[model samples]
Target chain A: MFLTVLSILGACLLIAQTTVLARMPPWLGNPDLLFLLVLFVAVKVDTFRGIILVMIYGLMMDIFSGFVPGLYPAVYLGLFLTIRYASRHVIVDEPVHLPPLAAASYLFCSGAIFLYMTIFNPGTDILWSWRDLLLQMFILAILALPSFHVLGRIAARIASNRRRIFSTAKGGNRFIS
Target chain B: MRKRSKRTRPIRQFLVISTCIVLFGVLALSFMGRKELTLPHRLIFDILGTAQSGVTGIINYVLDIRNDYIDLIGVKKENARLREEIKRHQALTVDYREALATNVRLRKLLDFKEQIPQPTITARIIGRDPSEWFKTFSIDRSSSDGVGKGMPVVTVEGVVGQILDGGNHRAKVLQAIDPNSAIEVLIQDTRTQGIIKGTGDSYRLHYVLRNNEINPGDLLITSGLGGVFPKGLPVGRVSSVVSKRRGMFLDIEVEPMVDFSKLENVIVIMKSNQLTE
Candidate 1:
């Protein structure tokens, strides 16, 4: 149920991103809500469920943007696994660490894509604008906390609802002594 | 560090093996270029494209209402200006009609062939590419509506793009401003041929020799050498011309005739043979 809800949410966010946010002024910079969702799943969800959700989001992104098929999935999964591994040793659960983490992850993914394109498709010209990159990084950092907060709340609600359903089922048991 | 249990070791191995397999699959797929849409990609397009179209419809409706309200604020001044502009255009139309008649007579005298109008379908812009790297957009029309891959999309202003891929009910357009896009164009006055390559927000006219007398504000029209776009369609106007000391070709920048960001509707010219793969 959590996966289902999150998937639907991700799809809706993608639609909005491509439709409405895409039409916004280029200078304002469209905030990557889906990237924030990926970060949330990486930090909050478990390995099995988180990886599945991340993969789904990445595939959805593949369908929407970029000519490369598997780039988003690889980048997303890499980020997820790295974060999962880093969280074990470091204190990253707090809100204070989210901005820098989001910023750094954004840079890593963008750099990875640039490297991939440069190596594989050298003929295609890719304009690397530092201004746009920094602006997007700043936007992601500012939006990271609130976007994660909302997703985290939704996840909590779903978990609590599952718990309540299980408790109610147990409470209503006629076979119990 | 604690030692792993015997049972957990196999599970860990399984996880590692699966991860490696997935990575390998991704690497293999990533290297491949754009191809026909798979079942999953098509399904996603059909589903998501419908939702995007519906949302865009609503947003456009609301925007229209907002624009109408805003227009009401300065109606009197705008109306007066429009009236004067219309009077001037009406006078210019007569001269244009006479010039057109003269051209027609000249064409008949020269035994010029009559150009048949290409079949076209209008498509509504549904969604745009989310990433800043690529300039692409999804349209409501698809293969069912005769919008096939490599169909040239245009507007009244000028050339828009070409159909990248088509699903059952939706297709994606690779905009002319995308880096991957290149169009064969000719300077209208000088007739010097060159390739116009997209540079994100604008186009760069490439391969024009330094000796070519290309100037800023010169119009560029499709040369029809590529067979993708029809001949004489307006592409852009040269915005700047710079002769660099290093290169043989003059650096030319162009401002596209079609405002891609403001485009809401486009016409796709259907061709029986797909010229581009």
Candidate 2:
């Protein structure tokens, strides 16, 4: 049930990203809300489910971005796996850990795209501006903590609800006993 | 425990191997150009694109409602003023009509069908390219309205861009100021020829001889050398020009006539036969 809700939410966010966010002022810069959601899924959800969700969202990103189809999937899935493996060794779910991870993931996704084009599609011209890059990173960093807090609260509620359902089912026979 | 572990191990291996194969397939498909979009690809675009169109419609409707309510405040005064202006313009239009009829007669004698620009279909911009470095956008015009790839899109002020990709109900346009865009142009005064390449918000006029009599505020128009854009269309105005003793060419920059940041409506030329030698 939760996964279904996430899927619907992901679809709505994807539509908003393509339509509404695309129209935002260029100087204000575009934020990757989907990436933040993926990060939340990575830290909170099961490994396999999170990886699959990230991959799907990444493909949806391609539709909005006008990029080639496979690039985001590969980058997003790679980030999910890396973050998931790192969680085993370190305390990755803490709020303090999310901003840097989100920033790094943004860089990794962008760098991989640049690297891919440089290596494979050299004929295409790519305009680069350091100012835009720095601005994007700064915006994402500022948004990270707030977005994480909001999503973390929602995830807590969902998890608690699931636990309550299971406990009630298991303890329902106490009156008969 | 041993039986369960054995069963799970092969399943995990199979899942991994299949996912790798699928990823490779997608990568290979990505390398293929946009022309190769298969049935499923088109279907996906059609479905998701409709959602984009719907969202844009809803937002535009709400904005329109707010604007209409605000506009109602001075409607009576504005209408009275416009009525007076229209009466004066209608009297002036009679003289303009006589001049226009004479101009058309003169053009017909000169075989003007090839000279006059053809009618165009207007398209509205619905979405922008999500990539920061790319200056492409999607338009509401589509193949059904005769919008085709490589067609020139323009505004009343100047050229806007060319269509890059088109679907039955939508099209993608690469803006004139994108780095990938290039046009053959000539300076109006001296007839100095150069290549106009997009450089972010402005344009760079390349290959101009260093000794040419170029200056700031010079007009650049499409030369129609490549048949991509019609001849004599306003491209940009020279914003700066620099020459060096060692180099054979001048470094020139141009300010595009159309303000892309404020672009809302554009007309796609249906057909243009105005080619020049």
Candidate 3:
């Protein structure tokens, strides 16, 4: 049930990203809501559930963004696993770490994509603009904490609803018990 | 803790190994340039495309109302200016019609065969690529509308792009400004042939010899060498030309005729036989 809710949320984000956010001027910098969602899942959701959600988000991105089929999934999954491993050792779940963590992860994904394109698809030229990269990082940093907070609340709400449903199914009292 | 870790180690190992294998396989497929859409992808695209179309429509409608209200602010002065412009255009239209009639008569006198007009379908832009690196967009037309991969999409101004793929009721367009896009074109005045490659924001004319006499503002039209795009369509205009002392070719930049960012409607030229190479 949580997975379903999160998937719908991801789909809505993807839709907005491709439509409304895409229409924004490049200088304004569009926030990557899906990437932030991946980060949220990595920190809050369990490993198996988080991996599934990440893959779904990655596949949605792949379908919309690039001609390459598996690039986003690979990048996203790699990031999810790395963050999962890192969080096990470090206290990265706190809101204080979001800005830098989001920025670093964005850089890592961008670098991996650049490397992949350079090595595999050499015929195409990819202009590396530091200004654009910095702007995206800045936007991601600004949006990271708030986006995570909202996603966390949504997850909590869904989990609570599931618990209530399960309780009601077990013949628990509706209001008092 | 050691015992628990020992029990789960094999499972973790298996998961990691399987992930690596799947990643490798997927990367291999991407490297191979797999363009075909599977059944599931098509279904998802249809659903998402419909949603995008609905959202775009609502946004456009709201924008139209806002623009209408804004336009009302200076209606009197704008009306006067447009009235004068209309009068000037009316006179020009007469001269243009006379020229067109004479050209038609000359063609008939010279036994010129009339070219069959290609069937075209108009598509509305539903969504755009979210990535900065790629210049692609989704349109409302699809394979159901006779829009196939490689079909040239154009606007009233000039060439927009080519169809990348067609879902059930929607299709993706690869804009001419994408780095991967290449079109065969020739300068209108000098007839110098070159390949136009996209440079993200603009185009770069390639393979024109250093000796070629090309200038900024020279028009470029498709040479029809590639079966994808039809001949004589306006592609872009030369923006700059530079001659390097070492290279065999001149570095020429082109400004695309179509402003991709402002595009909302496009026409897809349907060529039944030339859908794919």
Candidate 1 regions with alpha-carbon error over 4 angstroms: A172-176, B1-116, B273-277
Candidate 1 falls in which docking quality class?
Answer: acceptable
Deviation (Å) of A95 in candidate 1? 0.6
DockQ of each candidate, alpha-carbon based:
0.35, 0.27, 0.32
Best by lDDT: 1
lDDT of 3 by residue, A1-177 (tens): 999999999999989998899888878987788888888888889999999999999899877886777888888898999999999899998889999999998888888788878887787666566787888888899999889888888988998998988777657466877
Write the candidate numbers in order of decreasing DockQ: 1, 3, 2
Worst 10 contiguous positions by lDDT, candidate 1 chain B: B107-116
TM-score of chain A of each: 0.92, 0.83, 0.92
Better of 2 and 3 by lDDT: 3
Give per-residue lDDT, candidate 3, residue A60: 90
- Per-model TM-score, in order, reads 0.72, 0.65, 0.71
Write candidate 1's Cα lDDT for A1-177 as tens digits: 999999999999999999999888989998888988899999999999999999999999888886667878888998999999999998777999999999998888888778778887787765567788888899999999888888889999999998898788556557877
* Per-model CA lDDT versus the true structure: 0.86, 0.79, 0.85
State how far residue B82 of model 1 sits from its true place (Å). Answer: 30
Which candidate's DockQ is highest? 1
lDDT of 3 by residue, B144-234 (tens): 7678889898876678889999999899998998888999999988899999988888999999999989999999999999888888889
Lowest lDDT block of 10, candidate 2 chain B: B107-116
